[model samples]
Target: MTTKRKPELVAYTVTGEGEKAYWTRIGSAWAHKDGEGFNLDLAALPVNGRIVLMQPKPEGDAA
Candidate 1:
């Protein structure tokens, strides 16, 4: 069966190899919304990455 792609909440970190120690959110994929949406903490990753929110599986059998 084919699988569908969904959003997910994730945390990313940049890897500048100790050269560039800084990271900023790229693009306008998401915006600040209090404490209800994705709170990306790129202090660790130090690189631009995505923090998605994966869709929940359909209720019923655990495929």
Candidate 2:
């Protein structure tokens, strides 16, 4: 049996730039067993924004 682990990266829809930039949580990604690709699950797809992948923050830490 296989167990699911927490996502290593968080996906976001980004708009604007610099201090004015906005980030919206859109999905999560899990690396494949072979480490050659990732499995992405998105709640919504953006039409006019860019998708950015970043590491998840530690619990209780906000930046």
lDDT of 1 by residue, 1-63 (tens): 121332233233333546664333321223235646643323233334533233334569452
RMSD of each: 12.8, 2.8
Provide the lowest-lDDT 10-residue window in model 1.
1-10
**lDDT, candidate 2, at 14:** 88
Winning model by TM-score: 2
Per-residue error for 38 in candidate 2, Å, reads: 0.3
TM-score of each: 0.18, 0.86
- Residues 1-63, candidate 2: write the lDDT tens digits: 133788879899988999998899998998888999988888988888689999999889974
Q: What is the lDDT of residue 23 in candidate 2?
A: 91
Candidate 1: where are CA atoms >4 Å away?
1-36, 39-52
